[model samples]
Target: MKFKNRRAMLWHFLKGNKRFFVLSILFSGLVSLLDLINPKIIGFTVDSVIGTEETALSPYLESLILQIGGLPYLKQHIFSIALVVLFVAFLAALCRFLFRLFNSMAAEKLIKRMRDLLYEHIIYLPFSWHNQNQTGDIIQRCTSDVEVIKNFFAEHLTNLLRVVLLIVLAVYFMSGIHVGLTVLSAAFIPVIVGYSFLFHHRIGESFRKVDIMEGQLSAVAQENLTGVRVVRAFGREAYEKDRFEEMNQKYMNTWIHLMKLLSAFWASGDLIGGLQVMLVVAVGAVLTIRGAITTGEYIAFVSYNAMLTWPVRMLGRVISEMSKAGISIDRIAYILNSPVEEDPEEPVNAPLDQDICFDHVSFSYGGESPEVLKDISFTIKAGSTVGILGGTGSGKSTLMYLLDRLYNIEPDEGKITIGGVDIAQMDRRYLREHIGMVLQEPYLFSGTVADNIAITQESTEMAEVRAAAKIAALDEAIGKFGKGYETYVGERGVTLSGGQKQRVAIAQMLIRKPEIMIFDDSLSAVDAETDAKIRKALGERTDQATVILIAHRITTLMKADNIIVLDHGRIAESGTHEELLSRNGFYRRIYDLQSPEEA
Candidate 1:
């Protein structure tokens, strides 16, 4: 995944468009050559036809003119010479158009390829990478950094080649007129290029600083928008506004400073280029007066000098802008270089049946963090219902995460098996598809209620969706809305209450009819009456599937066939509700606290 240089990395994405890019450059060279010919043609017409002397022409060109009746025919039809100039101009314009067209094709294709790769890579990255990286920062790199690279190829890189060609061709033609003046005009090129290189090298760190600041500003805006409800509930609107304004001002200041530096570089380049032009014009005038070069030759020499001036000047700016592209490329490279989660080469397709076992499994969040689940062991029999009861930070959710293989455990630590086959050997996708989990805080995409419920199934039946809604006790509440199942749930289901959102999530999972269904404190937001109804409804439908329920309510777990009570990342008790009550352990204590009358 390591690239030898930024160019190599960019080329990895752009190589597919190599033919088009090469053609663009070739057309650009042709355009430069045609442009150079116009000035020479003008000089020839001025000397041979308009001036007091006849200019020497190439033998072939001279013979062609003689065949056309020599100077007499040309003098009578002076517009013929004008027609020649128009033809050369027309060819140059055509070449310029072709160059631009091909360059655009190459640039757009490269952009599309790069964006597709980045998006695909990001989604496949391990869950831990997403947790460690800020969402806004990653978004900035994908958008702004990608744009910088696109401009580098479309404008800076192509312009660099075109400018270099112009300079080479201009100097070559000027040398034919007077070697001394060509050298004098070309001397400023090195000075301008070297100064620009040094300036760009120093400016890179500043650009990076500005880029980082912009990411921070974007993150602030993203966070504020996502948590607008929380901010309003706490009456922190003023505080949020002040925080955003401060960051925005800082971002603006950094960009202002960078722009100032760029302006300074441009002004300095203009000064040097202006002086070089003056030197060329003055020296050519002296040479013409002394008869060292013809009047026509001097005019053409000045024309070539003017042609070279802007490109050499622009060459410096292009190089400087190219330096900015390097920074952007490095930023994008960081994402591309990160390794994605690897799936087994030859995965075992184990049927999700039989017992699920956690054989002395131990896990931490990695590094020096304390273990979240320590030496845990349990088993849920096939087609049985198991309830897990625990307080906050009791490793209840962590255990389920391991079962689903969202995070893998080290081989030496322990292992989980489904149907007596090590889950690690199974394909992650296949394993997850069979295990349906409704998270504690469920997230719903912006869609209609029916759309959210049927999201797991490609082709959804309204009858089946309504049945799942009834089992989760969400049918009546949805019916109350004007649009019913078609109601649009805004971002993250913000339009729904906490309990309604949780029930919608339950309906979503129930639609899949997974082999193993897990409810991770999913009913906590609903009232006790609604909770009892949901549990009763689910009990009837999920008899054939293995079910694991994680709940804090005593009433919710007391009906379970077996129960395990967790305390501080360890199992404190395990038995049926009656057996646990007899022991008077953590389970009994929790049951008493939730149901004082029953206790």
Candidate 2:
């Protein structure tokens, strides 16, 4: 889904929970109205009941007072006036409670919807999008940036509404006592709000810089943790520590600078608020002395003026803090706005167990970069084993990636077809499910050995897990563990060796029983003996399925039905193992170097 603007996005997330906020606003307005009643009550008590002055109350209030028995009864039962004040306070507190309850419910729901949508969108985003983005930055957007938006809605947005209502209502009430004083007090509202807006506007770029630095800091920590093994092996602990410390120091300095500006803004607000309060107090006293307003009216006007001061100033703080949300929203929008991987409206479900052809295929990582695979054309016949041999950067794995649609082969560059059906026309999910390609660096989630093997299935049977493991030559190693198939693999299979992790990945793919399987140097971590066992098992078991093996080792591919040599992203040679050796081309030279005595 795409959002036209930040407001549109916010409104979209607020859909289901808007009713809660509506109720919250109703209660909040009631609270403000309730709060206005007490000052009036205090003024009425002081003037009409205690002093010998007539009440200047609204007709509704006067009728109610008459119902309770006139001024004579109120004067006789003075404590009843205190009781009325306490009663109004109780109602105000109740309304405030309901307001908070409803507001909290709305905020929680909003946050949940935002997080769920973000996670779902990120999961379905194209692999190319993920490749171009950093894990740490994406994590920051999903987590920290999400929290900022939550605060924006839950605190600043709601509070801004409440405070603004309070300020307006307070001014309205104060005007009932003295219009000139009320006007003078309300004039400060715009000045304070405008000042805060301008200050925050200037500081917004600073906040953005800090946010970017924070993501970088997270990236540094994530990268270090992920490559801890390498760091330890190289004894680069001190270097890594220094690097992290430097980044952390910069992050701290940026935050400190922001806090200093925040302190200045708050201090300035307090000074302005104090001046406003002084002017109201001094003017109310002058009016009282001149007999222009009663002492009771002066007291109530001062009370109402004080009410306006804080919330008016708070209006500024809220507006300033909310500016941060704009930055956070844009950051999150970058993720939500990205188009997800999509298939054709009518995707084809073509049979995968047939000739797979790469026709004049050319690919570059990015369009402008030099090609990784240039004009590569080949065909893998049905139920046949084909071996791809190449050194590093020879487009060995790139070919398999194209076939599986992990990366699309451009229409102008070429197209890959399975059973004469373009893979692009095939449902991406269906294509990937049928073609299993294990990478050189295998990643295992934190789980038991059996759990990792049966990950593809929602409900697993121990029998199937063991069968796949046995084929991958992992059953023996698993049996040796004290917990056997139930043995827990630590994060990324850190508890297991490299060879063990690769075997687990192999078993994972094997359990799916895909029609087309590609091992992209997945066996590189294992010894020759284990490699031969796994390949032999696959050869016997997968006779009816098509298999493509990618490896740098000659012995691994020597027995395949067909061998294709890749050199610098082009097809160097293609034939049976013996046929390539007879021709004495690039494949023959690689064979001679690896098996010199045999050659």
Candidate 3:
């Protein structure tokens, strides 16, 4: 859950492809050796080309090489130095190519796993968490934030390691040429690193601002796309365009700020590196002209100094990259590791015979707002039908949500029970799986009619699917489509009429055949005749299943075995429809308001 250490994060990624890590280290180490050899080869080439008899010993390689084999061979047929030089250059290029190829593959594979894991985590997060969080913010964290981390893992992570390796190799050879110069060049890098850290602290908050801007952009994009119809219908294109431009400008400003600071870091590193090169060249050139060191030695020292600059420059770049990556990592990890819907870890089924109770249940969306549903108690025996009628915001839909355990309830409150067991004791997944829901607004995925109806590939038979469709009065509508059951619906079933979409949503639930069936104002889209037919079919099919209906129309719920009329968050009237009507109470008031004469 906690990525407290860098090595651990790296190790987690490496676990995905241990072979790649092995090759990365192997190739980098081999490349370091070849890198160290380049300067030595150049130094010898200078001596050999000039036919110099005296050879200056490398302090680093001297202990290893002269201790084993003497430099006497350099005094003889030194023509072999060219071949050695070519061999060193060849090995360096080969190792670099392999290291780059393998490290990139490793980063890509690691990122894929990370992205999937984060996506799965988001899916499991509770409704409450998502409600409080912005969709655009979550989207930005998943996309752009993850991209920065992936880029770091891909190029910069290895480059950081490569730079360190090159520094070590370059220093050993530089000390061979001139120890004083080696120390002087190496000392300036830490100051550059210190400056980079200073910049990180100064701009760390700006990176967070960039993330915020990205989220705002994402929210705007999602809104524009989802509500395109509304915007166009209202003729607000120019207004929205101006608004979008404002959002874009904010995003552009944040990006420019980050770029400016990063540019300063890059420019500073280049300036120092230029001066370092000039100083080292001046010192090395003087030694060569004074007859203390050969022209070849001087040239090799210059080459080594040039090699050393890359690592110094890499230090600046790596720190900046990692600083940004750190911010992104923390943001992403926070979301991916968040607590999710608190379902039972190991799920079990509820008893089939027990009554489903809503015991003094209460809930609120957030803040100090009054509860959406107050302390209200009710019971539905197995195989019974219950109907709820309420004005808007009277908690009709919220009541149905409790049966599916979409919202967590306090244990101290009156609890819902299936048979004798409490609903909260039952797993959230099990409760949802066993409860079928059809919302007021139906959302159909972009898939074939049959595919949408049979959401799960398992337990879906063609005959059963068609049967369910017929029960929901969707069979005739499907038949009219060009491809019938195979017809592909566009996003959210935009191709289908509102009534047809409702029927398809009903058909989907019918295929599931859950223990608790809820129609939350689901038939409001259809005309009275179609609504009646669908209700008749539902009553026939779910005779033994517990049915809960929330409706605005009197005819929709006129046949309910038990009806509860709600005012505010409490039950205002509860009885058989006729009994409530006969009492001349809240139910009658609704009947008079909605349908003066009941059909």
Candidate 4:
């Protein structure tokens, strides 16, 4: 089934480049037919010029011309026939060359098409799927592994097609001259193909491991590069080097296995082909001597045998490459075939009026483990702020994710509703459209300040985007930039300070103007002043929106209408700022520790 999935993925990807894909194969097949012609032309020329007949080409020309009663320069015409044969051979080769060139270009176009399709799909995958998978693993799949597959397409795909055509045409030509020799030539096909397939399976396993190793190596390198500062701060350069070398060595071993399979594939093909040649020659020479076939005919047979060498041998090489590339194909298909997180039921687009409710909501991923969120009940009135404070592993963000229905598999236990309509019953897209999120470490795209701010909801007008920026308090900062809103940010907005990234993220969310805004400790990077200003602006900007702010800073939630302090996945205390402080529970202690002035 996975194999079928892989084929389906390839078809889907190639559907965009169907014309180029089809044309490339046809052209490669045509070129391979020409490949058969050169040897025949050479053999025919040899027989005509040096055969046991007198007057190389004149006799036939003279006979033909004499029959027409207009013989013109018979000797010169004979010489011209030889020139014509040479020219025909040259022209055939020229056509083959051009066909191969076009074929390669077409394959490249197909690679681009596949790459774009895969990359586009990746960006759209749900965060739940991406959260479980590593960034380096995904990156390796898109780059090195995909390149191996692309190279296989641009080179070996046609070569495989060419081999099939070459053998078919070669066999047809040889059989026309001598049926027995052609049969003898093809007798090796089964043995060679069988042996090559054995190596194919072996190499496929090797390459799959190679793919895994590549991901590991990429993970190490990517982590080290991204966290070089962390590495140096801890002062463990030698340990990191040893770690990298170990992964590199694992990759080297996988490479060795792949190389061995390639070598064995070629050797077995060549050996079987050589043995087949011996049998053909021994029988053909005896036939020649007995006047059953001419010396020239035997020469042509040798030419056919010579032509079989590359195709049969190349058959093995192509098989090996396909095995490796096939592993890559499956690796990529694993991603493509994975079921993305989908909404549980038909979505309701009703506007919110009352409190959000969690009726015994419980969830777990994959198997029977302790529930991540069990009997998680909640309520927050419309146009109010709700704060969730919990220990590190207490499902704080998980609760927020549930509101967006980011998981395909819904909670096994209960119902969560907004405006009396169950969230599970609401369309995923519509729910997300009405919700905005800013994570603890806000991610920014590689673009201008305006682009990152307006990413989720695109409006072409710069003035409109700046309006959101001004609300998030990023307007003054952008104006000071050399290019203003047009100023380009480095990758991941690495050039921007942490607080700046958070503000831009908030600006992005603000532009969306969702009915429910979720902040998963998003303001941790900002100074107290900026945090207070943005919170104030946010409260005003969304006077009718429900705001859920998750934070460790007690000051961040002191003014909230409701605060739910989570202790071991249950609410320890839930009330307004004054009520929770009076309770002297988790919220009270945290607040005291954070804001001694207020405490």
| lDDT per residue as tens, model 1, 257-339 | 99999999889878887888788889889998998888889889989988887777667668878876877899999999888
Q: Which pairs of residues collide in candidate 2?
A: none
Between candidates 3 and 4, the TM-score winner: 3
RMSD list, candidates in order: 2.5, 2.4, 3.8, 4.6
The C-alpha TM-scores of every prediction are: 0.93, 0.94, 0.88, 0.81
Q: Tell me the spans in candidate 2 whose CA falls farther than 4 Å from its real position.
A: 205-260, 492-494, 596-599
- Relative to the true structure, candidate 1 has a C-alpha RMSD (angstroms) of 2.5
Q: Give lDDT tens digits, candidate 3, residues 69-130.
A: 54556445465666777877888999989987887777777778777878888999988788
lDDT scores of the candidates, listed in order: 0.88, 0.88, 0.78, 0.76
1-599 per-residue lDDT for model 2 (tens digits): 89999999999889899999889888988998898888888888888788887867789988988998989999999999899899999999999999999989998998899999999999999888999998867987888888888889888888888888888788777888889988888898899888877887788789889978987898899989999999999999999999999999999999999999999988988898899889989988999899888878888888888777767766766787897788889999999999998899999898999999989999999946688998999999999999999999999988888888888877799988899999999899999898887878888778888888888888978999999999899999999998898888977443898999899999999888899889999898999889989988997893488989999988888888899999999999899998999998998888888864532
Q: Give the least accurate 10-residue stretch of model 4, judged by summed lDDT.
A: 48-57
Which portions of model 3 miss their true places by more than 4 Å?
1-14, 56-81, 191-222, 245-269, 342-348, 365-367, 457-459, 492-494, 596-598
Pairs in clash, predicted candidate 3: 354-419
- Each model's total of backbone clashes: 0, 0, 1, 3
